[model samples]
Target: MKKKKEPLKYHIFQNITFLLKCIRREHPLLLIFIIMQVILSVISPVFGIYIPKITLDLVMGSADTAQIFLVLGGFGIVMVLSMALSGMANEGKYIMYNDMRRYYQMELFLQSLSCDYKNVESEEGQTKYQRAMSTLRNGDWSGTSIMIVSSIDIVVSLLCFFIYSGIMSSLSPYMVLLLIVLSLISLFGTRQAQSYEYKQNDLTAAYEKKLSYVIRTGSNAAFGKDMRLYHAGGWFQELRSSLIEESAKLAGKIQDRYFASGVVNAFVLFLRDGIAYSYLIYAVSAGQITIPEFTLYFGAVTAFSGFVNGIVNNLNELNGANLQMNSMRAFLDNTNDPEPETPLALSDLKEYSIEFCDVCFSYGTDTGFVLDHFNLKINAGEKIALVGVNGAGKTTVVKLLCGFYKPDSGIILIGGQDINNFRKKDLLKLYAAVFQDIYIPPFTAAENVSMQELKTTDRNRVEECLVKTGLWEQFCGQPTGIDTPMTKEITGGIVLSGGQQQKLLMARALYKDAPILILDEPTAALDPIAESRTYEQFHEIASDKTAVYISHRLASTRFCDKIAFLSNGKITEEGTHDELMQKGGAYSQMFALQSQYYQNKEVAAAYAEA
Candidate 1:
């Protein structure tokens, strides 16, 4: 579908304002960068028309060698200035580009971090981010970070166009008019071609993703065993080859579009220059202009044609980039209010228990419910375990509580007030959650656990939690102790085992010690012994704090004050583990199934005693 277009003038103004902010931050580098650009833009036309005109006239007028040499010396000086400015302009572009890009990247990242929680997770929100990233990753002034440079180019191009138009006017006004009309035709054709190129980006992105999947799977040491054992190397090769062939075919189609557009532009420029040069030659032959004048007019005609074409081309590029810049703007301006501005802060959070009352939710339309009228209540400081088979909405409840997604209907309350009434960030302050997905950043262990940069740290507390979680021994072995980076993706970093990472995450949660603590399969990577030790300690550690944990191992739910079995979008069973086992319902059946191995162990031990 054709996207609705916004005005180029509006984007230009936006670009200016964007750059102005950047300039304010790093004015010295960017100011020099822009000034060098303007100087280069102006000098190109001056060299093409003015200096050449002067040299030709001087040489042709029977001027002395000494006099001509003076003019030639001036030519050398101009050349030197242009060369130096050109070098600085090119070099400064990349340098300033890196700085501006780093700045913009941080700003955009912070924007995403501060965005509405729902906006960061929804399909629509993810698409906006991908689009914004695509704009930023391009290595040119057209990229989101350097759009100010492109904006400046437009202004400089316009200024140069006018300056040259006046210089060319001595030849003929009609010539300038003719050039603009033809150049505009080329501009329109090229814009359509470029639009076609961008339309193919979705296909290109898909192809790149496929290639990335193959490369990642092939290159990763973790996947190496699977690839070798399964004999999947040939399969990967075939998949990669097919994708490359498909990309080549798509590239051909894209190139064909550009070639077709090129034909139209080539024809227009050919006709324009042919008519122009023919007119100039005729005027000179008829004695209407002298040899020197003919030389000057001929130069002007060519330069003016190029000047008109360049202006139109930049205008079209700006128009195209305007659409791309929309993605950046959309993400930055994603301020559609979902929560209250002046929300009540629950500074004292120990008094509240999270409740989901008559809650209904689905990931999207036409999908079956993940949760439906899922009513549950817990008293403050109660430790509850939500246990279920996969796809039973155990994780869904956690997400809703964390405000990652909103329920389609009904309300989630904390301390009798709707959670929606509180600021999203402030509401999140009540919980310290360790989710199933493990993401370890390449930062010091202390920073990773604290989720903050170092200024001051409670070393004793950090070590105590690490020791309690079975990670302190490994921490002490490291040269920097807890200050060691957790990823070998950086220098002198240490890679942790999966179980150790889980322990680190647990230590992180313990360090936060928020009023509400949620752990989703926190000990999945640990052995039975380690898991038992952590669960036993959790009771003491989470005392006076509301705690919820999700685990498939129903045996571990024995540690909770209450065990809730979630099934078919509702809590099918809720009670103490012994009470549920006595009731002999779904929870009992699931627990028996999950604990059958342990049951065998107990039976074997009893028989041995006999």
Candidate 2:
């Protein structure tokens, strides 16, 4: 089915109207202030047009001197009043602009955070989010302020144009018509220039993303050592310089074209002014107008030119803001996924037994299967260890179980009910996972480990989690303790080692206290003692929870009630650790080799300790 398109004028007008409505709703005083400014703006041009006529009358000695003095005084009074009102309005506009942008940016951030994780993982949704964020922070700062000012500029300009043009047209209608036509052409050119600049902004979004990645890799302390060790500095520098050059070139071209268009517009204005002046001279020679009339018409034409230029430039600015607003609106409008028919409340989660029947999955349809016809059953309170080599679909299983991705064809059941029918939020609350790669948020040590915002978290829970993970001493002995900021430049935050960070992450899982826990290589980087101690702690805390572990280290699986051995997306063996060793399959072979190596190392470590 074909869809209808909204007319551009209609959309622009609607946005402007909405902008005014929102501002009035948010800050009524500011609207009143701007309305007063607009009135002063309209009156200022009128005063400017009449003041010269009054001066010319006094000079030519053709009018009452007292009347001319009064006109001059009136002009000064209006000018003073307009300037005072305009100053106040400008201040209010600045405040309103900042407030409006801040309000909308916060609203968008909250909405993005609340959206489904599945949609966020989608390629299109990610791009849309990135575009909205970049535009909101960069070019959308003026917010509705630009639209309000532009609309007022256009109105005042049109009013002045008509009033002045009407008076001047009486002297020479042809000249007034010629000025009007030129004004329209200049406005058209400015709008085209604005659209070209908007496209340039859009084209730079991908470059912005690339640039951000380069910065993260090059400058971040965590990536700093890796970058140098791997000699990735040159590669990243090349990529960064390339994107910077491209962006500079594109921006330069856009500016040059816009400047050229402005020059063309100026050339047209020059010709129009020359023609109008020549007509004015002819009118004066024919004795058709007095000296005062000649000055009035001449002043009016100049005022009209200013009006035309002001309206065109304001319109272009408003058009650019509209472009940013449209991008944000499009992202917000489309990112919402279809709502579930019935929400599954978290109260419904009772048992953690999981069943997958005929499950088939792929990252994309074009990509080969990460899991094919995969089936597994984990009993309630079962500690299952998943053994697999790298890229053996180990992490995919954990992601699927956590409901981050759905199977292309499968029925994944929890407590004999299909997970597809489960409310996503409720399902998320049912499981806790510690992935291989952990995110260290720029927050306090407690907040980073607990994954809680400063405003939303309970201090007691934060303390308790830290204590459980053996990180409380380090956290509290610091200058600000849990209240400390996490960054080095920030006050009162002490940095912890990598193993300490991992323990803190484990504390977060413990805090979640869900029925199911998934730990993916939690001890991958830990020393032998810490690694074994971590599993022992997990066994103690997760005794009543369905614990799933993924690791290449076979020594870690000894505590599991059941083990699944995977190779190339397929599970080839599943049983108790003892049963798998007896089967002498892939699991048995890998286990024997690792156990032998580790056993000798442990013996030597014990001898050193003795």
Best by TM-score: 1
Clash count for each candidate, listed in order shown: 0, 0
State the weakest 10-residue window (summed lDDT) of model 2. 2-11
What is the per-residue lDDT of model 2 for residues 1-610, given as tens digits with 9 covering 90 to 100?
8434343333668788776777787778878877887788888778877877778768677658777778788779879988888888877677777777776677668777877666677775677677777655753245355666688788888888778878877877887778878877887887787777766665677777778878877898888888889999899899999999998998898888789888989888898788888888888888988888988888887887788777777778778777766766656665544546976555675777888787888988678999888888988899999988888898888878767777889888887667766777777888888889877666887677657777877778888877876778886767788877766777665666778778878888888888889899888877778787787788877989988898887767878899999876678899988799799899988876665564577763443232
Per-model TM-score on C-alpha atoms: 0.87, 0.86
**Model 1 CA deviation exceeding 4 Å by range:** 1-13, 32-36, 43-93, 116-131, 141-153, 164-171, 334-339, 348-350, 477-480, 488-494, 597-610
Taken over the whole model, the C-alpha lDDT of each candidate is 0.80, 0.77
TM-score of 2: 0.86
Which residue pairs in candidate 2 have backbone atoms (N, alpha carbon, C) closer than 3 angstroms, thus clashing?
A: none
Model 1 TM-score is 0.87
Q: What residue pairs clash in candidate 1, if any at all? A: none
